[model samples]
Target: MPADQQRTDLLPADALQGKQLGLSVSESPDLDRLGLLDTHFRMTLGELARTVIIAGGSLFYGGHLQPGGITNFLIEELQRYGRRDRPLKVCLAWTVHRAMTQDQIAEQKDILGLFGEIHFLSPVGDRLDGPVNEATIDDPPAEERSRALTGLRTFMTANTDARIVIGGKRAGFQGSMPGIFEEVLFSLERKQPLYLAGGFGGAALDVIRKMRPEYAEWFPPAHDMPVPDDRFLTALERIEEIVSAVQWDGFENGLSEDENRLLSASYRPSEIAALVGKGMGRLLV
Candidate 1:
């Protein structure tokens, strides 16, 4: 049976609730704002009973290509609070833009199990079809990964009654969000609250503000500088530090050519630029 089918009790106070705020990234400096990130972090962790779902392919699956240190932080945090007890379910929806070996799949499994179930929505690759241990692998045919976004959007909308948290894997996912903005609007119309996890910038935010004025208040005010005490910002900074350091640091010492290719492909400059902006700042301060 699906996990959703199981009988569930009213969520505890610390569990996730309906109608919460989301974090949109714009500039690298925005991540330094202690005021904004802090509040978002508390809301994320405090609302334990809520389901926190993140989209995008890079953040969760990047470890297959390189030592994506950010993955470890999320695994550690999820392990710290054992999802069975906490109200949170961190869903990592991955697109199989790159191929993986069975051994690679095993590693992903281990990391995913630390939290709730890892659900893989990879377009069916011949390589990834067999006995993977951890994630519930949904291997669609070629080109299906892109199409699956609709199914993904449906899952988000249908599951709104539960204390639901939603985010994307990286900035690119947010860039793509406008393409699926209608789905988002429908979900929000149904009162499904989502967290815009990837970093945002002023220009991109202006686009968003114009796109959805009703939800404009949901975003934190545009700050020329960051707020110092934000927990979510702190977390974001820590994450950026880890990912950035690994990107250029000595972590690539042992990776294969394929692994290196995956790493290189993950950082699509055009996509990232379009998502955040040509002069957009990173989540890292």
Candidate 2:
């Protein structure tokens, strides 16, 4: 992002009008290695949410809705600004919704109703088949639960206009692939305005490593990290396949290649919001 473009005054207030942005983020295992703290990630998330709402856009989050979880965090952010009822959209997969007792679900629904809507998605069918109801399954097969989350991500992608990815875990995910890797692949598949804020150094940075290998030097070395299993390696290979077809180097989000390079390596929220605001204002026009 250029100095002038980053000026807060230059940001487009209505860049996201009528557009919903998908947020793909998680607790990264390597935040420390990148000289970041958990608060840094949390602050960035709040800042981005604030930026989006202020810019006349809503948000979508497909995750749990615990008291202090990301879902509520966004809800809290939405409350900070005025809008139509339920400015945020929270998507819940059958596997996740069922994990909580019906009473808990009811309780959450009551709270979310005030700030955003909750979408209860039935389990996906076929190979990763799930029942077609909101009923909770007790101790579902590990694979079934994981597949359900994958289905939720797909549903979220179908609904949102663009995406911003940041801190993500590499493994131990309920989904077949690491959630971050799979979600990024889906956004790439759709050619949605994808932004990879790799500066915080997590799985998002890892994904960028594949897209622009020459920028490998921008990330922290991975020797001390746990080795990824064959499954993770295979998922990563899928990223290359997706990006190759999409020509991701072209900066499809109304930004120049140079601006995107800066986006991938920036940790500041102001710059992220400005880059996204500028790109969306033009790309979405």
Candidates in order: C-alpha RMSD to true structure = 18.3, 3.2
Model 2 Cα lDDT, one tens digit per residue, 1-285: 657745354345776678888999999887777678878888788878877777778788889888888888887777777665576888887777777777887788788766788777777611223223456576888877887888888888888898988888887777788888888888888888787888888788888888876554677476777778777899889889888887763258887778788878888877776777678777875
Off by over 4 Å in 2: 1-7, 125-135, 246-250
Question: For model 1, how does the per-residue alpha-carbon lDDT over 1-285 read when each residue is reduced to its tens digit?
Answer: 432222122223332223222222222223343234534433333222122321111111211123533344445555654544322223223443224456875676665663533334432212223444444444645345444444444444444331111222223332223323424343444443222222222322223333333333445675554443343334334433543444322112233333222222222222222222111111110
For candidate 1, give the lDDT of residue 283: 15
**lDDT of candidates 1 onward, in order:** 0.32, 0.78
Q: How close is candidate 2 to the true structure, as a TM-score?
A: 0.90
lDDT of 1: 0.32
The TM-score between candidate 1 and the true structure equals 0.39
